[model samples]
Target: MKFKRYASSFLLQIALAFFILSCGNSAEKKAAEESNTETTSVETKQKTILFFGNSLTAGYGIDQDDSFAGLTQARIDSLGMDYKVINGGLSGETTAGGLSRLDWFLEDEPSIFVLELGGNDGLRGIQLSETKSNLLAIIDKVRAKYPNTKIILAGMQIPPNMGQEYTEEFKAIYPDVAKEKNVTLIPFLLEGVAGMPELNLPDGIHPTEAGHKIVLETIWPYIQAKL
Candidate 1:
């Protein structure tokens, strides 16, 4: 009888051990499943951004990560904001080129747009009317297809060599369009870096890496307000 009791006790201990292991496995599986669910939720909540512009937007002389768009995206991410900025800048893209591709970009239906065009038009001495018309067309298309998308028109200034009359006409185009279209206007995208040699790259035009920082500082207040 004593031997039988001992065997029964041993069997009970074995059963208890098995039950504990089974419970532990179940708890581990539940934890793993919950972790996976949380990961998926975070990924799904990410936001999308669309950036439209020229070489300035593309980070010509600097690493892609140092570009204005890149810096802006990093800022958004660091701030723990849900956003993904798509870089749509072409090396020598003009306002006309951007207008041509409006239909294709509109398919994404971005939540916001950083409109940084027209600089090449000014550099190339393109007709102000033509430049304005192209920008206006882009604005119209954006308004029609994605009315809720907030547009931040990044403006540009003309060089003194371009002459006062021509420069004024070119400069006026941005505010005029933004006013008419009711979009947010960031006057002078190169605000602090334009005439400052220290802030400019070798081209005497595009901003250096430091220049991009200035650009960020100049537009950040406006961008934050809109956000």
Candidate 2:
């Protein structure tokens, strides 16, 4: 009886030790998996450059991939950049509309912000002061959200039908904003593509695929400098 009791006690001790060791191994494995997951999340988080604008930035009638922003993304990939380009464009979006939604996009905390709005405001003949105010507000909001973020303002122009005075005023808005905000400026977003029938689509407003290539060329230098 004494021998049997001693044998039973020894077996129980062995079982308890095995159980404790198994639990320790499981906890260690779980901790390793969690650490790996956290490392992957940090490694995959890329810095972002946000392009915010109207249909011109949205690629209008063309495929989204053909837009200047998309082409810019391809260029970034080709150059093996660690930045992600986000096209935050919408068709027929006005300065006011952009102003209202600017906060939403800013939530992502972009490293660089390309402001391309106000074209629709110009086309619609909205007051230049109002346009300027909205744009200034956007810049202020972006600065508030990301104080160190680099900002690029794309200049836009209205057609002569809007009258030479209005057109000139519209053309001056971008450079003026860039000066006041102390931001970089792309002299004219549509420069070579604007007046050329071959470069524009049927609407003569948005750029065709070929035109977007030109647009890319115009802005690439400025963007490269920023990057």
Candidate 2 stretches greater than 4 Å from native:
none
Stretch of 10 with least lDDT, candidate 2? 102-111
- Tell me the spans in candidate 1 whose CA falls farther than 4 Å from its real position: 1-45
How many clashing residue pairs are found in candidate 2?
0
- Give per-residue CA lDDT, model 2, range 53-120, as digits (tens): 99999999999889999999999999999999999999999999999988889877898899999988
* Model 2 error, position 68 (Å): 0.8
TM-score of each: 0.79, 0.90
Q: CA lDDT of 42 in candidate 2?
A: 86
